[model samples]
Target: MLEVTLREYGPAVSVPLSSEVGRALAASGILQSATPDPVRDGHWLLRAGSRVGAVRTPGGPVVRVMPKTSVRRLFFLLGFSLDPARAWRDSREGTVDTGAYDDVVPALAHAVERQIDAALRQGVLQGYREVEESALVVRGRLRESEQIRRHFGRTPPVEIAYDAYTVDTAENRILRAAADRLLRLPGVPGLVRRRLAHQRVRLADALPLVRGQELPRWQPSRLNSRYQPALRLAEAVLRGASPEHRPAGSGPLAVDGFLLDMNKLFEDFVTVALREALREHGLTARLQDRHHLDTAGLVGMRPDLVVRTGDGRIPLAVVDAKYKVEKADGLLNADLYQALAYATVLGLREAHLVYAAGRQPERFHEVHGTTAGPDGRGVRLYQHSLDLSREPDQLLLALRQIAGRLAGATHDRDHEIPVR
Candidate 1:
């Protein structure tokens, strides 16, 4: 798979695939530049100046820039230029392109701060502070000379120990620019704010590198993958409502259902919803039992979904839908290998390994060419995830992206677009 090793902690963790790794890089703010890995491997491959896995994606250049988070929370900490990815690139061309990316973390931080201030003003999360004024006792000395002993008198207490609620010494520690404000920091790109299992908004790791020392301190944001899951997202929303909590005996996080059959979990409503989403985009796909060639004495393979544009149409793409969370990005490697095998069978030049974004958003991947196709044509791999939770606008946009790519490739890579 994608061998990801840290530059400093290179031996601590070498993951094959991960989205958490991407978030970590964003928070570190050490990389000079960030891009996707040029090689094909299971890991969410990312590359930077002497740094790899800086912003890893499933299979394309669009890496997961932030952790899985909530709409309301992200609304406060982040802002997209309608199509930030496209607009960010257009910023240099002209008038503050909305579709262009500025990824100015500080700008988003200010926007978030304003949103939070508005919310607070509206009593969304309001708190009151009280400070009481009290008189202070001052020590004074009477005349010590014998001749002035009779002149000893209590001097008016001078203004000592002054205190005011409006004025503070360490104001920055208690109140400073919010994350939205800090996001304006030149290097800060996208910021995601979410609470952790500890019921606290993760400010930063316990050992935050600050002031040339690793100190436990507050930060503009945090980097955590556990809170990036659906269950965690749910908990963040339904907090304070002690609805039936999952018992500890429930065991570790796993596929929703495993008592009956493991693979059957992919046949549930979630999977169906995903396929429906693809179809709504004008792409027809369905799950069917398709067996790979089984040399009489050899093994064979089975795919969850054998999708095609239509009959008489060489399958334009092979897709394998996954239901795991972003943390389980490792499981994706096997899926990629399986999909590639399917592409080989149908003589397809590309295959899409799709994922269902339970609580996260869609992660875009660039279209890349890999091994040769059945006809000795170059085979490419693409990765995409459907944001089941996003509005229709997102789905439409995603559909347009795929259609545009296909239309573009026809002219240069092929004579004409395929017709089913």
Candidate 2:
């Protein structure tokens, strides 16, 4: 077995790799580009973008992309995005061992195992699940239509459906599925694997989910409150991994890996946090609010967020979140153009753009307009940056301040009713 390591959005590194491995990795969506080394034969140069995770190429090296942020912060973002209300409780109580700094795969496996263990401390969750089957004896209810159609008025075997109180419920199935996935992934620590196996045994009665099928959905409630944190993490594990892919003729490359796109993660965290913050000020926020740039409606756009009144009848401000750094030239032209379009379409005087605050600080660009008067007809595009490295409370506070600014925007729009 061979192994390769890289950093997210880091400089390209030359690694000894066979053509087979290089091709597999390039297509894996892990590397931004994998090119054959100009001078070194049988080697390739690989660079990663914002994606971070470990990918095991069949009969090749396991390529891992480590994140730029610390493992603890990464977990915080993931947890907060998954369930904002309960993330604080889970973070305080849950014990997640994010091993050595570079060991992301092992860290996630360990974290998941610990969460699952904590969830099952009392016992496996059981609920009434509707089951449909053909049996010799009637159960909770008889499927008259099914019996008539399948049996054609025959006796003995009967089609019936019943609600069976058992452990094979959606919540348990998700747990088992996540554990099963972790067990198959490469780089998981042995101790973590053993613990996950034990957890699987506890959930043995719960059927294994079919790969490529939609996971069973479970709603959170007081009855299963203990399982909420574990369930959220498990679902993230099951949903975040890359699907298996086999190139044109290469013998089925078994690519088993879980990756989190930092771009999408940052956007989700910012929008969700802002939405939560707005509740305090009686404002509502919509993620990916849809609108048309032109009257034809053919040119459609979805802003990352649109803050509105509590009733959602009015649009207060438009916001977009960017995960990348600011360009040397200035605010990214494309981002500025897109923000302008959002403001123009929504007919709002103010729009906001949020960026990860590493490369630049917070600022605003007042777009040029002829009627820049006291009426506030000019569109003010505010650029806010959230330092992901800041403490969780501080990060939330930044969003709260942004929420306050958004709340203030409402006053300016009090008299003006923009075209919806």
Candidate 3:
């Protein structure tokens, strides 16, 4: 199949493609926009949004959208967001070596393959799954009600339910599904595919998930602790990019690919990191905390994070994470207005805007007439920047500093001390 590469938020590039192919690619939802080139016929100008990774159109070019950040950092955000407490610190699933692969798809494949290998080192995990089947003899428990309805009290075939101790549990099935998905997509390195194939073979006994069905849910506990990391990554893989089918009359083509939205990724990572850091200061955080913008509760709002005091529902600080590329004019004023609204609804004197650092520096604006605080300032909207290119540790450190600022503001408010 043909292949073309584009960069996320990069300048639009023109690539030669048929109308059908270009339309299918655009409909696949991997790029920001794809249109026919003004001067060059049979050429399409493609621009990428925050969503990155690769998408393969049915019998068309494999359109890959590369992230602006290094593969290492992107995976770091992914791993950290998947499970903030353990994904990075103990398992290091996010820090897996991606130096060998330049593309996100291969890097994801490499990372997942390594995690799967680590998970299956001790052999496939086996657990008891409740199963139902029609059998000649009763094993665990006979379904008398069903037997009466179906067989009219026949003994030849019995409808029974039993707990089967096998490797066909949810965890193994997820692992199998993820590997299968990666294998079907384009751009996976041959060696990675081979290794993934081996993992699939090892998990052959596990039932593959049915297409278009929701993933089987699994819970974390001491029993499946060894498989938690791989399971988390697998679930992310399965859910991240869904199959975007090409419109009909395209010759029965199936578009298969995976994509991760950096906007959601950065927001999750920042909010989760902030939540974890707040715990150390004896504070609590709610992600996507829901509230109403109007007293009548007609207009609703959900801030990225709301810091609260120890198990209390009252919010102390409101935060919104913006993963936007810098423009020449400067940061948008609409972000400030959004923060102001959140602060006003939460009845707070200040709000926080956390953005991925680019050309903008940290600053705060005071809005007049929105609140009557001790300093007579309406509301304070502080804009903070997190430089994503920093190492993971430095990133977390930056979050801790932001958390400290948030906590300090809360303390100052409680004592009627004006916050600078």
Best of the two (1, 2) by lDDT: 2
C-alpha lDDT of residue 36 in model 3? 92
Residue pairs whose backbone atoms clash in candidate 2: none
Instruction: Order candidates by lDDT, high to low.
Output: 3, 2, 1
lDDT of 1: 0.34
Ordering by TM-score: 3, 2, 1
lDDT by residue for model 3 (1-420), tens: 777778888889898888888877677666788899999998999998998888876556788889888888898888888778764374333545564787888998988889898899998899999999899987999888988889994556999999999999999999999999999878899999999999999999999999888999998999888888788888898886545566556666656688888999999999988998999899999999889988899999999999999986778999999997544444578987899889878889889888887554455667756656797666788777888878788788778878988998333344332223
Measured against the true structure, the TM-scores of the candidates, in listed sequence, are 0.28, 0.92, 0.92
**Residue-level lDDT for 407 in candidate 1:** 28
* Residue 177 displacement (Å), model 3: 0.6
Q: After superposition, how far is residue 323 of candidate 2 from its true place, in Å?
A: 0.7
What lDDT tens digits, residue by residue, belong to model 1 across residues 200-287?
A: 1222221112322221222222321111121221221122111111223333311110011112322332234334444544555545
Backbone collisions counted per model: 19, 0, 0
TM-score of 3: 0.92
Query: Cα lDDT of all candidates, in order?
Result: 0.34, 0.81, 0.83
Q: List residue ranges in candidate 1 displaced over 4 A.
A: 1-284, 312-314, 325-332, 357-377, 387-420
**Model 2: ten consecutive residues of lowest lDDT:** 411-420
